[model samples]
Target: MAEFLANYLPAWLAYMVAGAIHVGLIINLVAVGALVFIWLERKISGRIQDRLGPTRVGGKFGWLQTLADGLKLLTKEDLVPGGADKMLFRIAPYVSFCASIAAFLAIPFAGGDYPFIVQHVNTGVFFVLAVLGLEVFGVILAGYASASKWSLFGAMREAAQVVSYEVPLGLCAVVPVMLAGSLDLVVIGDVQQGWFTNWLIFHDPATFLIFWVYFTCATASVNRAPFDLAEAESELVAGFHTEYSGLRWSFFFMAEYGSMFSVSLLASILFLGGWNGPLPITEWLGLTAANGDIAWYIGQVLGVINVIGKAVAGVCVMMWIRWTLPRLRIDQVMATCLKYCTPLAAAFFLGAVAWQWSLPGRTFFGLLESPAELQSVSEGWSDATAAATDEDEPEASEDQTVSSEPSRKVAAAKLTGAAALQIASTNLQGGK
Candidate 1:
């Protein structure tokens, strides 16, 4: 029976199994992480306001509060509003959820030659950003289809904010990409492999400054607090998904939490050195690509733990910020992005470039390797450069002993006379 099954399946089926494993892992991360975050939010918000939150439902921690809520949502009647565009309204939540899920495909949960990357896109950074941008489409469609004035207003504001913030977000994101020289997230992460100082956040003074800008932009791009004018409960009254209920409503929350985790993952990649922990435990223990054991599942397990630790820490910080700060007005949010974030990000980008040029090998205090120089050195010896240099020299540079005598230009009158003679010969032949 085993032989028969093996014969039926292609040898590459193991890779398919690996892909399925990754998908399962990501889905669990999103679903389980959402459940935990929701419960934590309730408890934290309650404590901040001096109130008990959900002590009755589960235990001292109210661990099962989200599960209970999910149960209730499942049992609730799925209501479609009379004025709603039924098809579009119903489809929007899944769209949002799917977009969030798709963003995970390019995210690497570890660093190594054989890391736990799902799709391994060459343009992984852009793919994540582009897929993330698509999440807003679902929000806009939800608002339009809901046929509610408040929902429409909220969705318009969200669309504008997301679209606007993406500029600074992209600008800030490019700083790390410029420092790393490749858009592949795995490559970017791998570049920051040594110490905590090697992280892009500490690459230079300019990159350090850009880190904060990137954080702010990432927060805004994810529609978190201060920039979350879209779903300001006191103002928009549930916002774009106002008309949504039951399982549909849960889907929007899933998308929101999923996006929160996505941006946290992004931050982890861009600034936190990805799977490279501050302690370097993995490397210290001799678990790297150089060692054959790195190809084993144990390495993957270590990477997953390392990456998730950073990502969860990021998300927790975001939650802390959310609970601590007041939501900013839409105008204030726009002003911050355009007036402050844009110029700061631009200046930092240039400064980092200059720093790389001036101090190519010299690390600040000798704590970290200059990622820029490493990128430059790697690029210098690339096949593309070799090809270009060969193309530039038909003959070797040392062999440039050709004559330097000036070549005479053809006289315009002589060329014209030759043309006329040729034309006359042609005419005579035609006449004959």
Candidate 2:
């Protein structure tokens, strides 16, 4: 994009223009997406409990209700507790909000050679997790600055919960990265482009299991219901934001919703094939870069929709889980993380390693050939080598065919040691 602009404008101006576009798009997506999700959550919860929600406020579906609430918040006076530390109290929410928004900088909304991302950080996963974790520091500051016992307790719970869940969360996240061979989300999504079964979640029994654990930890990490001990309404009176109100309070909620979507986006990119749809309709229709820029443009548009749809589905599931399940005690929450999620994530991680080792080319739980049905190439290499005589021998190609590349590795296991050594010795003598 910058290059295109640079041809018509100054280099610096083109870069500035590119940056502004990214910033604008992300800010709007975060801000507007939160509004939509808030309204959607209310409707979902209402439906679950058998009632109408927010129908009178806007139009048919109460679409404008969240905007109305935003306006109300904007009109309200911002307050700081007299006993609180004014500096941190004033700044904490912005700190959290900024961290939440910054996470999207590394997150790609679509995937391809030129992905829709703000920054293509090499360690994209690492960068996102680190940025997301910084959000709790703001909550900690909010809790401490509020000078209320409830706020303090909420902040401490948040700190402990985030720290604890991060362990299993990181473990589960690593399973996909291990499979994808790159931390770049673009690469991860691209790896699963061919079919739904190629998605990392279905790569093996272990990866399939690991996806669930990841989602469980992510829900807890994001402080969604059943695990939202940080802001337990009955116990903490609004928790870390207890002493907050008005626009500032809204910022904290915005941050929460943003993080919710960010984590969901991350999960989609990792395990659900990011921008790739279940059926590969785009591929089948020949909508790819090779077909021309017009086709590529259409494909990217479809990709954007696929990505947003998957993310929205994930968020709705979270809302469903929130309303359906009763909240757990703090002890139970900690126990759930420690006793179940962590060990299961670790076990799945190990299982993926073993599966990759044993059935190197297998996919879709071994229903298809591992390494994408390369048996013919391996067999052909072995037959040609085995058929070679003591004289007039072909040059050795086993090492090249059966080296560590996953697609080329099946031949190594098939060739006997004596046969391989004989071929190697023949090549050494001939030097042809």
Say which candidate scores most in TM-score: 2
Candidate 2: where are CA atoms >4 Å away?
370-432
**Number of the top-ranking candidate, with lDDT as the measure:** 2
**Per-residue C-alpha lDDT of model 1 across residues 1-432, encoded as one tens digit per residue:** 222345667647755666677788888888898998898788777877897777867878889999999999999998888999999999999999889989999999886677677787977877898799889888988999999877887787777777767766776677666566667788788878777777888878888888889888888888989788778888889889888889999988988889988888888898778887776677678766667763445666876887788888887878778989999987678778767887787788778767766665444546445555344533432423345565643432211111000000111232343334434434643664
lDDT of 2 by residue, 1-432 (tens): 788899999999999999999889988988999999999999999999998878978789999999999999999988899999999999999999999999999998778898878898877887898789889988999999999988987887787778777777877877777666566677777777777877778888999999999999899988999999889999899999999999999889889999999999999999998898988899899999999999998998999899889989999999999999999987678778777887898789789767765665577654676333223223333445456453432322242222224221222222233234334434543662
Off by over 4 Å in 1: 1-8, 11-19, 50-52, 289-291, 294-296, 365-368, 371-432
Looking at model 2, how many pairs of residues clash? 3
